[model samples]
Target chain A: MAHLTPTPVIEPLQDRTMILNMGPQHPSTHGVLRVILEIDGENVVRIMPDIGYLHTGIEKTCEAKFYQQVVPLTDRIDYLCPLTNNLCYALAVEKLLGMEIPPKAQWLRVLLNELTRINSHLVWLGTHALDIGAMTVFLYCFREREDILRIFEMVSGQRMMTSYFRIGGIALEPPLGFFEKVRDFADRFPSRVDEYENLLTGNPIWLMRTKGIARITAEDAIALGATGPTLRGSGVDLDLRRDMPYSGYENFKFKVPLGKEGDVFDRYMCRVAELRESLAIVKQALEGMPEGPIKANMPKVVLPDREKMKTEMEALIYHFKIITEGFSVPAGEVYQAVESPRGEMGYYVVSDGTAKPYRVHMRAACLANLQTLPLMCEGRLIADVVAAIGSIDIVLGEIDR
Target chain B: MALAPPITDLEKLKTHPALASLLDWNPGAIEGVKFDRDEMSIVIDRAHIRDACTLLRDHREFAFEFLSDVTCVDWYPSEPRFEVIYHLLSISKKERVRLKVRLDGSSPVVESITAVWPAANYFEREVFDLFGIRFSGHPYLRRIMMPEDWNGNPLRKDYPVEGYR
Candidate 1:
């Protein structure tokens, strides 16, 4: 019986590096990302990233759709921060249309975008902690994320793909109790953040795994085009919200958090600090809720009021016409950049005097940030590869779009 | 939380000293400059893209250190079939400028600015992937968002949105 039983055999490589494939299906690769790592024993010699498994060709699809019709497509790009994509595309098209959005709409956009930031960060923290072997923190983060998702569903009728931002303004004025619900959530969120800190901040294992690992310099971050927390974690004090304000972000008071060590732990601290700043902005927006129309006054580009469409013949006709034959934009191009959770999400839109765009290109932050992976992981232990990937906080949908 | 001043003003950016210095650097390189809806766009000859980008990045007064985006536009039946666009940012100034280079349909080739700003690496690869446009000296220019063995550049005007077998 012992002779009949087969034993598993192991082979060893001497004086040679072994090739290992990390993903396309692995759990910790985040989202369909594949990395080919060359390793010498436990140390990574080199790494090459292979993307595009999730490419939807959304950029090509934009050419066939109307300007207003493209908003829904942007929602699919970065699922975590759908409204930021919605806002960036809307702002670029709005620049071409030359329309003035109402102040109320602008302030609401500011408030919602901040909420989107918190939503995205929560997901990052949960999955990141889970990857690093902290199970309790993952569950706690999702509990709060559910509250935020509920708020999104209450306003936009969708949980994750809430394309709440329209060209001229937000999709709909939020329901009556929306602000109150948001206020309650905002009030309770800080203590929850404190709870997250209590779980991970003092844990020696968390510190040992994250601190001083996957380090990047400020200059390296800037040159590699890392943005959002990844860039800020490297001591670069550049936030589009503060530096290049759009959608009334300038009206809100908040701080841009910075990290000096440029390590995984520093990135974690920056994001935690950002959660506090975002909450402050949300509270300010709620307190100074403006009173005015939520949509722009441009009848040509904007859809007729739902109330007006019922009775007035003119409103009904305009609504029918705009929905069927989308408004035409002047022949030109515009670039709009917004501070999404991951980093700078930009849209370069070109119009050719037609309803359909001549070209629509997305400057996704995750793609550029992912390029720095090889630089950080090479010459380090293979265990740190997961930490490096998690620290980048990449969403493959955005990278491959 | 309280209100602070707005961070972006297109009008103030229009009169920036950096824009003035860029025009002064190589008068022959620029074709035209236009300001619309507070965004400034400068059309430059395709031949001088690398030099112009180098000037924009290295020159102290016009320190456009960030190459935010690189994309292309196709205008079928129009004289210049492709328009390669570059969006540059001056972080210290909080200002943005758009640079355009028109490429004839025949070749659609231009110099790579990756040397000036390493951030242009992935962006240029993306442009190559979607537009079939080539960068002159790109270290590794290949399909980024598409499979290595893909057919045509899907973003071109003639390529059907449904795609080809």
Candidate 2:
């Protein structure tokens, strides 16, 4: 009887937590990120992030290469906005050498960067929506993204890994009919954005999954080193291009979208708004497009024109020296940044008057922004994980790289 | 204000005599100002990093509130074996400064900045994972990029360039 009966007096038992490793290989992580979470009955108590699983030693590899050769590595960094990475690096190196880029090149850079921004957002929106079980949005996004990729192929001759932007300017002069194709895409893109908005903007499912989820205060976001859409979602007015203008962004007239509540929904809306802003910038670039040289006049640094090498002996010798011996940067270091689709993409380059860089480092925004994941996931349910990850809009190439 | 200068604290920093040492050297040797115009920074020795950083934080004029990035570089059996860089931010002044330290060969140990900026926890771990720099005060020093039982830091100078597990 005593064994079967419940004690009248109170007895206490210890509560234990369970630790689970999400991935160095799990597909949803978007990369090799392993998030160690402590759970109590499907509720997360603590989260620890494990990174560097895909560390390709890209930074160290940069040391063995000349400035121009490193553009290929930037393509692999985010894998989404390859042109943006190219531009950021080129700007930093150009600044180091105190070289001036022509207006046409600067404007063209803006145009391409904006297009690259659109491409990146579409991917993020599609993947984020799919992760939350909205299959149609993913399909629709991919349909339009394919067109963008085709255009990229037309201009750069490479689809995803286009190291199209060279140190001084573009690699190829935006191939024949490229401008018209971009214009056509820009013309139709606004309606397409609305279509995406129509499907998910007011949908109860999307709202439930996103709104009031993964909320971060402005102070907390900044304290965590957050930038781009994530920080904008928290209503921060800081924009690198606007506040610290680079690549002739001060000339463009586009609004920077902000969110009232730093939630998954807010971030989604901010990115959608950014899509429109990019289209506007692209249109402006084409309408005011200047007819001039794309690459700078630096024969030693910039690659020589294919025809010029045949006609000019000096051009031939310069080309040979650049590819064979490589150029040496002055002894110093510089950290340059630009607004990539994700956030602030910065490249820190150090030179000791050598063909190869003394040091090359990247401040990957995806990795930095993803650091706030645990803070966003702590109180939410397990199912909300998809929405939270979507909100951050991370590309593993950048995170793991 | 000349458009308020991109960074808020340019003139104030120029007035400080402590940073005057930079003016004596060629601008190229100091590298160039990065991110913004007002932001003042330069590289330093790896061994005296702790002392130098301590002074940077303690000094009245410089209040680097954040450590934005801590990354390493390997020159491949070259002059500068390892370059560990630290990016600092002064929120009050709205400026950023980068400090670099060089380690020529083995024993790539640099003082930890975890105390100065708590955000350094993740960054320092990445440096250790890639370049094998040992941060003395890191609470739970472990390889972030590799497995728990992994062998060598892949970002080192002598580390094989091509390998996969």
Candidate 3:
């Protein structure tokens, strides 16, 4: 067996090389990520990512909890796009039960998931710009992000940890006037994106820092298992929404944005373009919003309506049974993937005809995307390492989980 | 966004001539093939994973070039207590197939497919970290999400979810 220790390269300037631990607490590395960089003066020669400071043993914890209990835990896994995690887990469990969610639920899911994408991108833009020392853009980005968070509160009650999407459908019918509020934000969002572009897109300093920095070819990006904006920035025309449509994403009319250079600038442009496209999708969803039951018809799998639970004896018993003992999923496994803001987020869930999942493995996009940091960092200046990490848009919660 | 026609078909994958030929090429490597819930999966011997993945990636007709994920299921009381599953994808073909290799409960060890797909490095390490299933040829097979001196693989069924002794 090979030694588990990393073998550092003893190059010509070995004496000049020094290892720098970037962050377990530093602001720029995003979450509790510590990158051990082997540097020769300002140039990086090797990098090792030290993770797991935030490992909550969530996967192991899932094995002990019932299926529904796991959804809140999923939210904490990728806090940026918590709804995306919720939807992916719900879809996987629903597949096991062969449950068909109502058309309204599916459409609502597409709308909420798009909003999650926008919310996540807003944070990415704010922090990414802040890392590059563009102060005003951070404030501008947060202003818009606040609107999205408020909209989330309107629907899910909780701002960040929204365990909104349940196993069979959404937790509740969206509050009245929810569509109009989202519409008001969606109507004004394109110009906000333009506001961001005006601030940084054409600025020579912004261009210099982002245009060629952290560049990776499409082949290398794909080989490293990068997806979503990171892969799209590298000119890979793959979006799980368009390619493998789920949760009624196919019903809306929108474009799958692509970029050619696969650089920090291209990634920025791709995300900016995505912000516009997501607005378009949200508008389409609002126009085509279906009127039907929010939850699936399966009483065994889906919780009954509160109104019905009060009136009907059968509904009351079903509700009591489901609440006390979580509904059991079929003895099978399914892989459900969703196009999250970061990348292709997948949930590989296994059930053994039990209330608890036998195993639930999150195919976290951050973990895979973070692997390419060393590939992008080596042979580059230490300053660009921060830019590269920002461009990857990782939520270390997801990676460490 | 008009729904793209469904890209993956289990029936089509099961009958793919190239896939059939690959199965024929390695007579004893495959244990069984199953299509459940519209997904195609083939169970393979633990030792032949590298060879199987190589064929899956190299074959022109079944070019599963991307290794999406590597995970394990710990069936504690079952004879072969671990099942190492590999999710493979072909971007051009727009198809996905899972390859499963079951490892014995005692001394669970298998060949690593990092030779076939470089992306498998982190995923293999993660599997080893959580499941304590060692990859025989993995270059840096250390714990990924756990501390270096962690006591046990927390994912195994018998491993208590709460406190450690």
Per-prediction TM-score, chain B alone: 0.88, 0.69, 0.88
True-vs-predicted CA distance for residue A69, candidate 3, Å: 1.1
Candidate 1 on A1-401: residue-level lDDT in tens? Answer: 34222111113244698878888788899989988888898998878787778999999899899999999999999999998999999998988777788999999888889999999999999999999999898999999999999999999999988888888887788998999999999999999999999999889999999999999998888777888899999998999998888898889899999999899999999999999999999999999999999998878778877899999998888788789999898877778899999999999888879989988889999988987788788899988999999999999999999
What residue runs in model 3 are displaced by over 4 Å at the alpha carbon? Answer: A1-13, B1-14
Better of 1 and 2 by TM-score: 1
Q: Write the per-residue lDDT of candidate 3 for residues A230-291, one digit (tens) a residue.
A: 99999998888887888887777789888898889999999999999998999999999999
Q: How many backbone clashes does candidate 3 have?
A: 2
What TM-score goes with each of the models? 0.93, 0.86, 0.95
True contacts kept of 3: 0.53
The TM-score of predicted model 3 comes to: 0.95
Model 3: TM-score, first chain: 0.96
User: Can you write out model 2's per-residue Cα lDDT over A33-115, one digit (the tens) per residue?
Assistant: 66777776687777676666666767767877888899999898889999988898888787766677888999989998898
Which pairs, if any, clash in model 1? none
Ranking by DockQ: 3, 1, 2
First chain TM-score for all predictions: 0.96, 0.95, 0.96
Q: Please, what are the lDDT tens digits per residue for candidate 3 over residues B65-152? A: 7878999999989888999999987877777788899998888999988877778999999889888999998888888887776788
Return the clash pairs for model 2, or none.
Answer: A52-B145
